[model samples]
Target: MYQRYHPDKNANDPKAADMFKEVTFSYNILSDPDKRRQYDSAGFEAVESDNQELELDLSSLGAVNTMFAALFSKLGVPIKTTVSASVLEEALNGLVTIRPLPLGHYVSKRVEKQCAHFYSVTITEEEARAGFVCRVQSSDKSKFKLLYFDQEDNGGLSLALQEDSAKTGKVTSAGMFFLGFPVYRLDQTMNSIAAAKDPDTSFFRKLDGFQPCELNELKAGTHVFAVYGDNFFKSANYTIEALCAAPFSEEKENLRSIEAQILSKRAEISKFEAEYREVLAQFSEMTSRYAHEIQSIDELLKHRNEIHASYTITPFKRSTSKSRSKSSSKENKEDGQTREKRSTRDRPKKKKWYNIHLRVDKRKAC
Candidate 1:
């Protein structure tokens, strides 16, 4: 599609030129992950929100300038570059203002959009051994980039990107990024230096296990550049500072006391942990013993219930005294009546028979 829409090939057709621009714009958006994601989620509005493309007429430029521009663009440099190449060149030529940023002191500056501010920090060998840190704090909500320079062998300075606020977003109402210059110490007794010199070791692997020292054993003078880029479309009001990790006399004494206190507390915690484990073991043992005793008691109670069920005892009956007295009086009265009737019958039978015989004898004598 890009070849079909080549403006050079179809110079007579204006539509081909427009198609070429559209194809380039689409390619730019699709090539960048962030822009592509933004375009996918929110369409062109999000991808183009605060950014405007730089339109250059390639046909109007000289052949050499146009060739270099095309080369830079092909090398992944955005046409609307965030970091100004002129600023870097001016810095290398010593044309830009370079301020001295004292250790532990922050300097604030307002840099115009698409411009760069440079600051130099000095470090001693002793301070570098201990370590140091450099950071930039954005005073306002704006996008910017921080960079440190490395001296090349050809006496030119090369810029390395340290942090870009546009990528990280804001940490607070302001934005901040830590520029740690970690010190890597190679063991003298081993072949660690040879290992470090090994061609196969990747750059990042060599940086592993580094201590937090920003200007790690660097020479006395170094410059860091902070740039306010066109990407976010605002000037940057920010403060930058470098801090040394070396301790002062009073602080060294205080740190020693604090270290002593920390060691004491750690010992106490270790002792407490041991005692806690011992007590926990004792508690578990007691719990087991109690559970066994309870089980034994429950068994004994069940056995006693079973034995009680095996023996059957009859229930006693209780009578009142008044019912017994009534029965005895009734029996005595019946016996008295029976004896009186028997006596009357025995006396009457003898008297009646004698009287009848005497009356018969008197009648005969008359």
Candidate 2:
């Protein structure tokens, strides 16, 4: 409708064009389900009010069920929590017998490497309640499995950074610790940029040496691992093996990793700011220079217009009998008179008769 009723197309009546814009705005809002729902349910005022509320809550019932299952497994008790809808009443009644929820044992397991171990990690149930960390050794230079989960329901397992691996997890090492994070590729075509921007944030969280695994128990798929320093390890034909502990001894490591990330991000921002300033300064300088040039051009154009106007009244003439120098001198005198009228206060300046002749020839050609 806008194209149909644009003022240029429908000079007789353009009011319909405004309606087209309004319709487009309404359609944009209605296209999004959340925005449409907010608009329908609460109108524009309520939508604006709701945007300020950001608290998110999720049910812990699923995790509770997993905890119960893990506990039953450890105790050598075989039980299934899921029941048919018909037995729902029976299940609810049976729950009365178990007094408060039970916290399962925080299991800490250690794997040893043949090489001299420089680090060891230990995490208990208290740590696993939220999340925990562990370290594993990589025996293969090109490829190695870091996590193996036999049970599909083993919970989410997160593999943290390789501490002593060929990679340097520390940020200060080479400004490339982000490469340490575990990445999953659907195919070989995947590059590091794609892996970093991948929506599967579950894998990227471990770039820091301090992130908790989502899987309560690390015993699912055969997971492979690598580090940024793999190139060095590959050349040396050496492997990295380190001990890992979980749930963290305390939150200090987590805090430190987070701090390091913040600092790194800040450094990047500073670098960008410096570059931005330099570009901005260059742009400002260029803009000023352009403005001065434009002003000079405008003054030159005004003088040219004055000369053209004088020729319009006086008309052109074909000179004859005079020497070439005399004809040139006569043209220069006319140009100087025009310049004098335009710049009366300024002293006489050198004139370019060639430019005037060229411009006049162009006008004649046109």
Candidate 3:
């Protein structure tokens, strides 16, 4: 259908051009998984909200170029021929302004929508071995995509997408690219074997399914391209930077040593954790075994306290010394009086004998 309604083939027919655009539009939505899902659930409105309509004018392209573009589109690899491929070519041909991007420094540029900015970065073999990362930060909050060129088998340039900010939904304007050295890959695998390593690094954690470029593919001199896509409405003012993973080349050896030590420490930690868990289990078993005894001992102590309290005696209080002396003196005096009374009673018998004579006299007188 694309071939039949292609603008180049039907150059005289305006209706054919309209049909061609319509066919292209439909193909784009159906080809993309996200767009297709959106369209399936909520029709064109849902699809449009996420992505703008793709407009292609194949009439401006040669027959061969148009044929290849259509072929790639059918294969579900739609080519953005206008911005990415052309920008790379122009940079290589010295037709466009290519700014030098220094390592660890940011170079800022404003890129118009549907346009691209080019940058050149130099790296040494050591830096490449240690690994390098390139990042683009957008100031305008515009959605953009990063691109870089790879050498084809025929020594021609092929544009590759480094990162896309739209699908990632990270910072709306920031995207990062990293070329991981063989050593780094090996280190990662070793770490994975040593422990449960996280597949995503903190630097690119928000980017789902991010994969770094192979170190062998990265040469000493490389150019990076940033394409401000038409996904959003405005142009982007962005900064780009290239950084080596290892800050100093001499530190690479230290890094390897540290990694080995880390693996060793991780192994030690694993052993310690196992021992800790075993000890914890033993401690728990011992505690459980003694729990009933401890509780019973506590209960017995409470019972003993209750019994002791029930039998506890209240002692009588003693009087002070002064009151005791006073009471003792009074008792002594009373005792003396009793003794005198007893003595007088004994004497009474004798007095009565004397009185007997007087009593007899009185009786006579009576």
Candidate 4:
């Protein structure tokens, strides 16, 4: 029907031209087995890269007739047609199976590059509500483990992504391991680095030899991705993909306990600070009051010294005034006695004249 309805044959219909091109494009890819396989497996983009145009011959309409006959049979119609036209090219994944392969076959070939690796892991809300495990491994047989903490985990992934983009190729794995690119919590010194870089740190109870590097009860979002490797390993291949998930009750409880402890500590610190300030204020007030008291005592002591000096001089002054008064009284008594004796000597002559007159009267009487 493509040739019967093609715009070249039916020149008035522009819509039929579009249908003709579509039929030709499909035939170009489907007719070629190589292009058909490429289209089926990898999609149209692979076949389009070939960049071939298909020629539809009006004379050789046998295959086109057969194809329409089959399609119309399925649609309960009987039609066969072809078009004389050229096919144009155009461009545009599916099921994955998990089967266990022998370790020696697929494992040894998996090698790590000498660059910092960045991985974006998406966990669904359900996956985060339940806990998930992400497995990491190294190609260089490096021993290491993952450390999970709120403040530190996201920082590791960011640093690795930055370093991977900045480096020309990659530094040697030795340099990466030594510099602690993925941020191992374990020691990496010469003596202890060997034992400290234990690969499996997580402990599982029921499963034998089970280790769980799990993100337990994470908040629903994109989480931190990081890897830690041995300081001396040449190269290490690591995976940051979620493996499995399970519901976690203990994790929520642990978070609550930690939060309570933090709050308790903060309260204690605030209480201590308040008490310290109160004590400091009290000490300052006491110091000021005692200082004023000391000053008052000093002034009182000065006044007592002045009073003591005046008292010392006062006794001497009293004794000197008493001795001068005693001497003056004795001189005044001596002067009075001398004046009385002079008066008595001047009165004896008058007494003798009166006695002579009286003696003359007495001789007459005798």
| All candidates: TM-score | 0.36, 0.24, 0.37, 0.25
> lDDT scores for all predictions?
0.55, 0.36, 0.56, 0.40
How does model 3 score by TM-score? 0.37
Model 2: per-residue lDDT, tens digit, 347-366?
Answer: 67668877665425555755
Better of 2 and 4 by lDDT: 4
C-alpha RMSD of candidate 3:
21.7
Candidate ordering by lDDT (highest first): 3, 1, 4, 2
Query: Relative to the unseen true structure, what is the C-alpha lDDT of residue 359 in candidate 1, on a scale of 0 to 100?
Result: 37
The C-alpha stretches of model 4 lying farther than 4 A from their native spots are 1-127, 132-252, 265-276, 314-366
Kindly list the per-residue Cα lDDT of model 1 for residues 1-366, writing each as its tens digit: 434534355544534433433445566577568989999999888865322353333323456545544443333233433466577777676566767788899887787766777777777776666555566666455555677777666655567544445323553122122212322222111222223244333222333322222443444556454544432334677777777756544544564466456556656765666786689799999999999999999999999988887776853223545667777788888888989888888775446664775535666766
Clashing pairs in 3: none
Specify the highest-TM-score model's number.
3
In candidate 3 the C-alpha lDDT for residue 299 amounts to 100
Model 4 per-residue lDDT tens digits across residues 1-366: 655763345553434433443455677677768989999999878876422333333224465554543332233211122221211000000111122322112222222322222223455666554555444444434433332223233232112211111111332221111110112211111121111222221111112211221222455555443343322224455433343234335644564466456556656765666776689799999999999999999999999988887856435677888899999999999999999999998875545554664425655755
Whichever of 1 and 3 has more lDDT, that candidate is 3
Q: Is candidate 3 or candidate 4 better by lDDT?
A: 3
Clashes of 2: 13
The true-structure Cα RMSD of candidate 1 reads 24.8
